[model samples]
Target: MEGGKRGDEAGPSSEKLGELSEKLNEVCHVGEDEEDEDEDHRSNGVAAGFVPGPLVSLKEQIEKDKDDDSLRRWKQKLLGCLESDSDGQMEPEVKFHSISIVSDDFGEINTPLPVDENQIGRVLFTLKEGSEYRLKLTFSVLHNIVSGLTYSNTVWKGGLQVDQSKGMLGTFAPNREPYEHTLEEETTPSGVLARGLYSARLKFEDDDKRCYMELKYSFEIKRQS
Candidate 1:
C-alpha cells in the first residue's frame, strides 16, 4: 500500500518534470532553418536558443512550476531579450569587459594610445579579402531603466570612433553573429577595422551583484606597401 501511495504522489511530479523538460529543450533551440536562406548570417547562427549557454544541468523542477511566477517571467524575459532587435541601442549599465583585435600588415597601431600624427607615415593597412579578423568583448549586464529591458549574449563590436582630445570613442557592443553556435555564451565584439590609426573604448555599469570590468584597446591597421 505504501508503494502504491508513493506512486500516486509521484505521478503529478513526473508530469511536471516532462513539462519543464520540454521547456528546456525549447530554450536550447537557437538559430533558424538553414533551408530558409532568406536569413542573413555572419557567424554560426545556431546559438540563439537559450538564456544561459551550458545552463549548468537544468535537471528538472516539478512542484515549482505550479506557482513559480518568478521563474516563468524570467524565462519569458530572457526569450524576449534574445528575440528583440540585435542591432538596436542597448540599455545603460551594460558593462563591456575586454577588447582585443589585430591589424592588417598595412596597419600599425599597437599601443593603447593613438599614434602621433607624425607616426601616421608608418601605420597604414587593409583587410585581407575573405580573411576573418576578430574583435570580441566580455560583458556583465545591459538594461533600459525606463523600459527595464536587458540585452544579452553580446559580442565586441567594431566601428569605434575616438575623440583623441577627450579620449572618448564611439560606442561598441556585441554584434549579432558568431555565437549562433555558442548560443548564450556571450560572444566578443569586433574591433575598429580599417587602414589607419584606431582605438576602442570599453565601458561598464553593474547591477544584480555582477561586477563589471571595462577595458579598452587599440590596434593599428597596416598594409605592406
Candidate 2:
C-alpha cells in the first residue's frame, strides 16, 4: 500500500509539468506573429514616425490647381476693360478737330505745334461759334514730373499759352469769331517751373439718347522748329 500511494502522487506532478509546457508554447507563437506584422509595415515604407510617399504627391497637385485658377481670373478682368463699352458693345468712330498756333503780330503762324517751353508763342483754336456739341477745351502743362491743369473753356475762337517763368502759368481768351488771340507773358516772376516732356490733354464727350462716347487726346511738348 505504501508503494502504491507514492506512485499516485508522482503521477499528478508529471501531469502539471505537461500543462505548463503547453502554455509556454502558446506565448512564444503569439510573440512571433506580432514581430512579423511590424516587419511587413517597414518593408512597405510605412513606419510609426514616417509620412507616406503618395500623400506628398497629392499636396503638390493641389497647389498647382490653385495657381491655374488665379491666372484665369486675371485674364477675365483685362478682357472686360478693353472690350466692354458703355452699352457693353464695341466702341464706334471718334473724330477730333485740329488745333493750331497763332500770334497777334504774325496772325496765323506756321510754327510747329508744341513749341519750346520758353519759346513765347500762342496756341490758336477755331470751332463752330455756336454749336450744340457743347465742345470744351482743357489745357494741361506737364513738366519736371508734374502735371498742372491750367485752363478750361468752351469759346469758339481763342489762343493759349503756359509760362511758369514769367508767372503766366496758363491763360485763354476770346478774340474774334473764328479769329486769333495772343497769350502774353507776365512781367513779374512767380517761381521756377520744372522743364521736361509736357503735354496738353483734350477730352471730348457727346451723349446720344442711348449711350455716350468719350474721346481723349494727348499732345506732347516739342522744341521750336
Best model per lDDT: 1
Please name the candidate that would achieve the greatest TM-score relative to the true structure: 1
TM-score per model over all chains: 0.25, 0.18
> Considering summed lDDT, which 10 consecutive residues are worst modelled in model 1?
178-187
The collision pairs in model 2 are none
lDDT of each: 0.31, 0.24
- lDDT, residue 122, model 2: 30
lDDT of 1 by residue, 73-165 (tens): 443443333324332333323434333334342333223223345543232223433334433333333322111111221112245332321
Candidate 1: Cα lDDT at 194: 31
